[model samples]
Target: MLSNPRTVEKTALDEFISQYKAYIPKPALVKSEPVGGTLSEQIKRSVTVLDFVGQFVELSPAGRGLCPFHDDHRQSFSVNAEKNYWHCFAGCGGGSIIDFWMKWQDVDFGQAVKELARTLLKDRR
Candidate 1:
């Protein structure tokens, strides 16, 4: 939550963006290795779905957690470390880190991939 009431907007996206930027510095975005299949492939290979999502949501040993996208009662959200993908059984959809990022940030595929490169490349790989 924003402490200053004069702030423009206080949406979840704003908070998420703030936390994400703090976690990954701006300078680190260009420090990634350029030796992957493609942009999206490189981003996905940089970090696993389990590790990435685990940063924001606490996951059990089975890679299960309360879905952050919805009012999840059960631990409908699960990550496949081996496969490097996540799925929310509550109909929220499922895919790799880039997919989840796109949904979380409410951005398009291109923008999601760009942001993922910034976050995953610096220290994860």
Candidate 2:
């Protein structure tokens, strides 16, 4: 019997993953590529953080822009299309599109999802 609960859980999870590793794609792609498996997924896949951010911020030729969340001037913000995420080098915080929406709108997670669905899915319906 393993005394450490975390170790026991890890072992079980590792065994399960090894058994079904082929069933999963991008094992650690949770942050950028959310597995919502629904409308949110559509929203995420239909566009990228760079394009979304570009709608409001003026990005440079290389997709770098000033941070809007703070008083930045040296283009501390950058959007990575390959990773499908945005980040602020000035330590303002960073994450996926949903996180950006939440921060931009000054709203909570639920509000962010609702607004994103409304805006992004407006054309689908």
Candidate 3:
């Protein structure tokens, strides 16, 4: 038996992109759905920012708190219930619920969808 374990090197961006593209279904093979309307409408209809955030971290009533995306001393994030949005005032920036998951988990777009889908499904019941 070999004493050392073999490890594969990281793929280059071009190679990675090519591999990702290969897995994407052709336009004819994919079904499309409309994501209609404003971001506010989408959030309001689907889920609240507080509820979404609670899936990843504990939050307070004012909607301001330490962001899960980065290390910080105080809570600087705020969520607008009526607007269905959030912003990190401590220089961390902010965006929609999907953006929060992407930043907090350091994941790519596809992973973010999967994570949110799973979370939302569980919440529904």
Candidate 4:
């Protein structure tokens, strides 16, 4: 009854695939907000860069200090208490407290935020 066995098999397989393809379900969409927006702000306002960074590295009266991220003889790190920010003139880039924590702890952004949140929210209760 079949002239070409290969063509008949191919046609049957195509029909079978078409019949089952529509039964497959598509993945669901998920919407989520990024971590550490308001909490980071709260910590930035409440904690100064000098006070926070001072715990790790000793700072001069002018807020200039050694950068732990790099090896150097001179202290090229500067912390601006008013702006609650820091920067390393030698090379190491600086930012908010979260940024410092991420580099120091060698963790990702989410882990850093969670770690910071634990300390920041400790006294809330």
Name the best candidate (by lDDT): 1
- Candidate 1 accuracy as TM-score: 0.68
Counting only residues 3 or more apart in sequence or on different chains, how many pairs clash (N, Cα, C under 3 Å) in candidate 4?
0
Q: Tell me how far the alpha carbon of residue 67 in candidate 2 is from the true structure, in angstroms, after superposition.
A: 0.3
In model 2, where is the ten-residue run with the lowest total lDDT? 27-36
Shift in Å, residue 101, candidate 4: 0.4
List where candidate 4 sits over 4 angstroms from the true fold.
1-37
Residue 15 lDDT (model 3): 70
- Candidate 2 clash pair list: none
Q: How many residue pairs in model 1 have overlapping backbones?
A: 0
Ranking by lDDT: 1, 2, 4, 3
lDDT on C-alpha atoms for all candidate structures: 0.85, 0.83, 0.68, 0.82
TM-score of each: 0.68, 0.67, 0.55, 0.67
lDDT of 2 by residue, 7-119 (tens): 67777877876989887777565545435556667778777888898898889978899999999989999988789888999998888788899899889988887889888
> Where does model 2 exceed 4 Å of error?
1-36
Error of 1 at 26 (Å): 47
Could you tell me the C-alpha RMSD of candidate 2 in Å?
Answer: 10.9
Please write out the lDDT profile of model 4 over residues 1-125, one tens digit for every residue.
15665667777877877998999887888755446546667666657778889898888999998899999579999899878899999989899888899999999888987888789767852
**lDDT score, residue 120, model 1?**
68
